[model samples]
Target: MPNITVQLLAGRDINQRRAFVKDVTDSAVLTLGARRGDVRIVFEEITPDTVANGGVLASEDDSRAEVVSRFVPQASS
Candidate 1:
């Protein structure tokens, strides 16, 4: 049995996760000699507000403006 963990920003839809997990599992089964039924995968979704880079929260980081914007709704001008 093999345990795999993945962490990413929360926002991607379930379809993306499913596709990723399927590919990862297939690769593990083929390359790691792991049984398809015995491979365990875990996903940890983190909110932008909970992460920081360069001492600035991702929710407030200017460098992440474009990436963060994808998960947040913009104000009407």
Candidate 2:
């Protein structure tokens, strides 16, 4: 069995996760010979404020503003 853990900032849509999971799972099956049914994938979402890069918090880093802004929950249609 192959266990995979993905960590990313919160607010990603289901479609993004679905596509990523399928692609990664396919690669795992082909490279690791892991059974599709036996592969386990877990997602650990973190807030921008909880992560840092180059000693600056992601949420507060000016250079990352655009990227972090995507995690903001959008209003419904």
Candidate 3:
């Protein structure tokens, strides 16, 4: 059995999470010789305010803006 844990900022769609879990399970089955039923994946979603970098909350840190930008889709102008 293989267990995997992933943590990310909140707001990802449920479909996206499901796809991630499926992909991880498939990888474990192929690369680790684990059965799909024996592979477990857990996702933890946290708010930006709960994460801190450089002693500053992610919600308040300007430096983290670029990093977070990658995870969030850009809105049309």
State which candidate has the highest TM-score. 2
Model 1 per-residue lDDT tens digits across residues 1-77:
99999978877788988999999999999999999999899988877788998899988888998987786555588
lDDT (tens digit, per residue) of candidate 2 on 17-72: 99999999999999999999988999999887789999999878999889878875
TM-score of every prediction relative to native:
0.80, 0.89, 0.75
Highest-scoring model, lDDT: 2
| After superposition, candidate 3 runs with Cα above 4 Å error | 66-77
Worst 10 residues of 1 by lDDT: 68-77
For residues 1-77, write the lDDT of model 3, one tens digit per residue.
Answer: 89898989866789999898988898999999999999988888876677898889887788878766666544588
What is the alpha-carbon lDDT of model 2 when measured against the actual structure? 0.89
Candidate 1 TM-score, true structure as reference:
0.80
Residue pairs with colliding backbones in model 1 are none
* Candidates ranked, most accurate by lDDT first: 2, 1, 3
Clash number for model 3? 0
Q: In model 2, where do residues sit more than 4 Å from their true spots?
A: 74-77
RMSD of each: 2.6, 3.4, 4.3
